[model samples]
Target: MQKKIFAYIMSVLLITLIISGIFTVQTIEKQHFSNMEEKLVSASYILSQVLSEDIQADNIEHIKAVLSKVSRELNVRITLIDRQGTVLGETSYDPSLMENHLKRPEIQKALKGSVGKEIRFSSTMKLDFMYIAQPIYRDDYIAGVIRLSTPMKEIKGLMKSINGNLLLALIPGLFLSLLLVYRISISITSPIKEIKNAAVDITLGKLDPSINITSRDEIGELAKAIDFMAASLRDKINSIRDKNTRMEAILSSVVNGIIAVDSNENILFINPIAQKMLNIDEGDIAGKHLLQVIRNNKIDNMIKGILENKSFEENEISLNYPTQKIFRLNSNAIKYPESDRIIGIIIIIQDITEIKKLEKMRSDFVANVSHELKTPLTSIKGFVETLKAGAIEDQAAAVRFLNIIEDEADRLNRLISDILSLSELENRKGKTRYEIINTADKIREIISLLQNQAVHKNIDLIVKVEADVRMLHGDPDQFKQMLINLVDNAVKYTPEGGKVQVTAYNTKNEVVIRIKDNGIGIPKEHIPRLFERFYRVDKARSRNVGGTGLGLAIVKHIIMQFQGKIDVVSEVGQGTEFILSIPRET
Candidate 1:
């Protein structure tokens, strides 16, 4: 801006100076020519008066001598012409070689008894000249013409000198003008530069309210407007930031995952929940295509459908990549406010994996309970019918049938009790009773109670409690029940002369109890579902051993109440080990 202003001002000043100089030189040249012409006319009149007598006498030689001397002194060419249209005397040229003077414009007017002035090129001398002619008279009659001519070169030289002086005068003026223009440009552009810098700072998120411009002109007004605009922009940006922070908080706190995409299917936003649900990192995910982040076809299809239809859509999608999970996707098209133009889509994702598992468990549990109850009731009914059908008269047969019925009734009662206990555990919620339990005493009690069974089978029952085994914190009855179930299973599964071992120890943060047996081991595939209700490895053997298939399931519920984890290691015939790790505190 400074350079442009300076250049513009200099250009205008130069143009004005050039025009003024041209006109001034022309005026001075014109005045000099007028003064020179007047002088030549005066000189010619005086010379014409003096030469008239000589001309009348016809002393042409003497006239030539006199004109030559005066012409040399005046630096002019003098010519004398007769009225008969012949050159009489010439200073620089011979009179005989000169052209006729009667046809010359100045000579013609002089012959008419008046002075004449003319400027034209002289063909004989090959130079441009100014001519002034006066009539020479004798006895008040026209005798001849006396003419004086000077070359135009003298006038041109004078003009050249004038032009040179003018140029010299303009140099300092030009420099002074440049300095003034520089100061003016700085004054105007400095304020503009301040405004520009301030605008740049605003773009970089720096808002300075104290923009002190002291001028009262338009530039000052412009600066004030920009300062106000900056303040307004700062307020607007802060407001937007606060709103965005609140929106992020709300989205993070929500349980359901949320995603938003633009019309081009690029990701606009994704909450943390959505990032976790899709098993994707949240960094730099915005503006990426939806399929590039989450490769699930069901979610992509649902979003695409919402986009194309510009309406709501929903779907339940199962993901098997990161983990097996069922997600319920609810999607709807986003539109411009108060307008129907579709802009993007918003999707809400609800994880229903746990809910679906619970539903399935409830259905299976009902069927298993009915089947287990019906088996024992059918056996008892069959025995009773057999006794009624003349089996009572056969004394030995009736006694055997009644004993079998009693055993079936006992098994049924145990099954019912186990089912009720499992139901109670499942329905139990909130914190459990935290009682300090002696680990060695509990293991001993379990071993003692199950020892008879182990003896009946001729199996060895071993118990080990490490000295460092600390007291565990949990419901004492639940802890004891959990151990009994595990010990009993070990005894029941082991064949004759097989060994069962129970070891209790402590780690830094947990109480570890391990029950291992060298018995008819379970298959690797069955270990996962070993604790499920009514699950059995061998149905016939389980019934013969008076097993209800609910013991391990009950033990699992108790461990869960104590916030403990159980792991099973088994092979077809080697052995099975159940490791229970309960936290030192509830």
Candidate 2:
């Protein structure tokens, strides 16, 4: 701005100086010419009066002598021409070489009895001249013409001096004008520069409202307005920051994973839960494309569908990387507050693998229970129908059928009892009454009870209990029932002359019980579902051994009630072992 103002000032000054110098030179030139013309005319008239007698006589010596004296006095060239336009003599040039002056403008005018003046270039002298001519008269008849000429060098010298003076005069004025213009420019632009700097700080989020322009001009008013605006903007920014903090807290506290994205599928907000569920540890993934952040194509498609439909969408998405997880993905489009335009999307994920597994278990339990109950009922119905059709007439046949009916009823009763017991243990939630009982003693009692079965099959049964595991806290009946199930299963599965071993000991704050048998071992695939209700590795063999298939499941539930864990190790054609770990304190 200063430079622009100064340039304007200099331009105007230069133009003004140029015009003034031109006018001054022209005026001086015109005035000098006018003065010279007057001098020439007066000199010519005076010389004509003195030289007319000489000219009438045609006395060339006298005319030349007089012309020389007058020309020296006046410092001008004097030419004398006769009526016939012949130059007799001249002060400077040779008369023989001089041209006739008959057709000269000044001479022709002077011949007509009028004073004539002309400024022209003289070919003889090669100089500019101001010429004034007057007619010389003798007895009222024109005898000759007297013309006075002065060279233009004197006027030009005066003009150069005048222009020099003008330049000298303008130098100071130009410098002073430039100085004043610079001051004015500073006064105007200083405050603007300060305001510009303050605005830059505000853009960078430094909202300091200090501008030191104290004048009451428009610039000052602008500074005050900017200060007020900065205050308001700072308040708004702080309010927005507070709102974001609260929103982040709410998102972090939620149990479900939440993801928010923009219309272009760029991630805007992703909570820690979402990060964990997605197995991502890269911090600050916001503003990245959704596919770049989350690598699952199914979830990406679900988000796309929700955004395209601008409605809600729910899907069960399975993730195989990191770990296998089943997520119930619920997605919906976010819209403007009062308009139907879609903004982005909001997605929530809830893990539902456990819930699905429970549903499947319940469904399988219902089918197994129905099948287990129907088998015995069908057998009893068939036997009774046979007896009612006169099969009771034979005492031997009647006794055999009665015994079969009794055994079937007992098996049905055992199955029903085990099922009921399992249900009760499963539904039991809190701690039950637990008394500290001798661990070795409990194992001895259970083994003795199952010893008869082991002997019936001619299988060797061994019992081993650690001396240090004297007592553990649990329901003694449940503990005894749990051990009976394990030992009985081992004995029943072992072939004749096979060995079954039961061991109990203390391991790290828990009582460890293991039942091992050398028999046809369970297959690897069946171990995961071994404790499920009515799940059998060999259906026919279990039925033949009078097994209801609920014993292991019931034992598992009892151990769970005692806050214990059960594991099995088995190999085909080698052996099988069931290991139980129960807390010793409770």
- TM per prediction: 0.77, 0.70
lDDT of 2 by residue, 1-586 (tens): 7678667777877788789878887988888878888888888888889888886787878888889999999888888888878887678788779888898898899999999888788988899877898999998998889888888876787778887887798789778877887888787788888899999999999997579988888888999999999999999999999999999999999999999899999998899998989888868899999999888898888887777776685789888888778899888777899998778888898888788878989998999899889998999999999999999998999999999999999999988888887887777654566788788988898888888988899999999888888477778888888888888888888788999998888877898989999988999999988888888999998998988789998888888877889999988888899999888863
Q: List ranges where model 1 is wrong by over 4 Å.
A: 1-22, 43-105, 120-129, 135-153, 156-253, 281-285, 308-311, 388-395, 466-469, 505-511, 583-586
After superposing candidate 2, which stretches have Cα over 4 Å from the reference? 9-194, 197-216, 260-326
Q: Local error of candidate 2 at 241, Å?
A: 3.1
lDDT by residue for model 1 (435-481), tens: 89888887888689888988988998998999868888888888888
RMSD of each: 5.4, 7.0
Candidate whose lDDT is highest: 1
Model 2 weakest lDDT span, ten residues long: 425-434
**Cα deviation of 348, candidate 1, in Å:** 2.0
Instruction: After the best TM-score superposition of candidate 1, give how far the Cα of residue 300 lies from its true spot, in angstroms.
Output: 3.7
Model 1 / residue 88 / CA error / Å? 8.6
Error of 2 at 334 (Å): 1.8
